[model samples]
Target: MKKIVVIALLIVITGYVFAAGKSEAGAGGAVEIKFAHYLAESHPAHDAALAFAKAVNERTDGIVTVTIFPNSMLGNSQELVEQTTNGALDLVIPTEPAIAKYVKKFNMVGAPFAFKDYAATDKLFAGDFIKWVTPDLEDVGLKYLARWEYGFRNYTTSVHQINTPADMQGLKIRTPPDFVNSATVKALGGVSQTIAFTELPMALKQGVVDGQENPIATILTNKMYETQKYLSMVNYTYNSTHLLMNIDKFKSLSAKQQKIILEEAEKAGLAMQKAVREKEADQIKELEAQGMEVAYPDTKPFITAAAPVYEELKAQVGEADFDYYMDLLGKSRR
Candidate 1:
């Protein structure tokens, strides 16, 4: 009788332990998310991303973990987008122009003189503008999380300084893979050469191109100053990068997890933007200290030269939407 009672108690304890183990497994399993970007680790955006991943992990109680692959370790912008679309990548951040190739609505952001300054551009993006165009991304299997800044695109060269459109005449300028960028270079009377970002330094060093255009932060972070002798504070174009996720992968997350990710991304993006704003002047000064000549030329001529691109892209974005964007800019300027 004593032996039978002991055996029964042992069986009951064993069953309870098994049930607890199953419950723990159901609650403690982690969801891993892979995020990729093409910026170096020193970039503000990269730092912000790591912070965001940490926030998400903590907020979700370690149920969601984000692993970031920076400096194009995953692939270039185009390949990253493709991978995200196919569900191989969970998240990706690509510049507006790169994404503009898939959704033309983004092209409006890259138009010359799109906004008076970074503040105005930031306002427009932080407002209803992004919501209006986000629907277009769904068709491409992407879900827009937030708009992050890539800073203002400036001109740099090993040959001569650019003060006006004529200054760029016959200059071979390396541009990103964007039609608007190429158009802007052409409008400035320079020949546009599209080169891979990874190969830009070699292109500039080898004299394959006389100059290139990118944000101040990008030029500094990439150490293009070593290859390029001059920096022009053209502020010719505003480069906006968008944080995105695979729609299916996002939808697969629990409602709570999705909310945390979106909220965290926005927080991270705003922090990164602030850091860029703070560092822009400092970075330019650092470039000068590094032996690159800096110039602030009259931008009126470049702005006037770039006017045609707006007209050309207006037809593509439709007159109504184009007008809407202008109206937004007008409000922001005031």
Candidate 2:
């Protein structure tokens, strides 16, 4: 009787351990990835993230699954990246400038007036840029997956129209809490007030800052147009959100699973890029209809005023890397 009881206890204990392992590993021992980003559900990136998750799961036949947390549900942009780095999270999509905090060389991507248009961006992002940054990302326990569109940063002001660099002087501008953005605004002669995106609406309403800069889609979706009276299409800097995964988490996946994830990420990124570019004009129009004045300022003076920002980037990233990046940018230009 004693032997039988011991045997029964052993079997039950073994079963419980097996069940717990299976639960942690997900259904059928599938690998589950948690992806988080700051974009709201209305943004195209969120839709693309959902589609990416769906396609990845289908392609892998339940061998892998991705769950997305949008609208900073996990944390803000900077915090999300930190969590992914420490392996507390599996994946995150953060703006390029945000990544520069971890890898300083990434600051080159945010150099003011670096990209002329979408064609230039498409060429660079599709080329060796990813390869160049891969090792650096790995150093910080991140694997760069793909580049998705954020859009060209433009200025919107409640104080006055920003037709020239001179107009930006002394105007308090709310910028993302990143060095590149703050430097860009300061170089353009505006006082940079770094603010978290989640708190921006209240800041604008409270007159904490006179104006802000963001992509048209973001402005429209976030209702920033309600706070600001003017939109200036200076296109000072082009921005992209990079999909990153924890290196250890990515390495734990089988080769086939990794390949499938990469392919789906690229496809989803391209989809997002296409959606953003196609809707930008309509988004700007919507902002105008919301009682905002739109202006296509002569960007030459603005570009010239932004030259100091490039110098600062060069100082931060070193001369050789900066030159190499510039060469890549030049070659990418159509």
Candidate 3:
């Protein structure tokens, strides 16, 4: 299966390159880049990506143009990252957890209760954290361009209201295929089932899982509220989205082009963060209008329950790196 997938990927890449060359020749020598993400068009990430594309084209004066594939038109999160790593895709903005599969230190941020809140997260982003993570990425043929927000992940369940870790006992909850998410469910005493984001609605509708957790944007955009009965604001984790590109492809670009790409990516990320912050309350209200009950549960219990995850992940990522990150996260809160 791996060999078959590689062969298929090569074929796709070869075909795209050839077709892209011909199309660009016909389009008066404009370079074309493909950007992909797995989110609905209504998603803030999608809107931000479109803005990035527009800004790039305008700044480059039509010398370059970006074609975006939202909702995983090219592939799921894992496949997209792999494609970017192999230079088959030009860019992708995947969740930090997905990126953690390639770069282990990313797991620190993906771990449950990693950052105190968005402000702390921003402080880490503004500091030397990206520099610290760059070597791991460059070693794997990728480059981190910008950080976008995925907002705080909260619980939504059809089974019951979750005010404390005890309430989650024996409940089956869906999580993405990531260790932090699974460990979080285990710590809260729930059964963890890895489900693709695209299939989560059906999974919840058919009772395959009793509930799931995601940011409010995802819950509202994907209409998960339609299937889930309650939204619990436990703020168990913060979801972070990062723009990544093939390091080789980025280096191949002219210095000016590379600068434009990086600048536009940062702008897009900030735009996304602003949009998410401004729209969250409205999104929750929309979920309520869709018949979902929203609750702001006391999060101390959930935070206490997830404490072990920090030690477990720190051991996995190495004590030195873990301590460095903790120091950064700790200072960020102040």
RMSD of each: 4.3, 5.9, 10.8
| lDDT for each residue of candidate 2 in 104-214, tens digit (9 for 90 to 100) | 777888788888888888898777888888899999999988888899999998888999889899999999987778898898899999889999999999999999999
lDDT of 3 by residue, 85-171 (tens): 998999999887888889888888877876666777888788888999999999999988999889989889998889889999999
Per-residue lDDT of model 1, residues 170-261, tens digit only: 99999978878899999889999999887888998899999999888889999998889988887888887889999998887777788888
Alpha-carbon TM-score of each model against the true structure? 0.89, 0.90, 0.90
CA-lDDT, candidates in order:
0.86, 0.88, 0.88
Q: How many backbone clashes does candidate 2 have?
A: 0
TM-score of 2: 0.90
Instruction: Sort every candidate by lDDT, greatest first.
Output: 2, 3, 1
Total clashes in model 1, counting residue pairs 3 or more apart in sequence or in different chains: 0
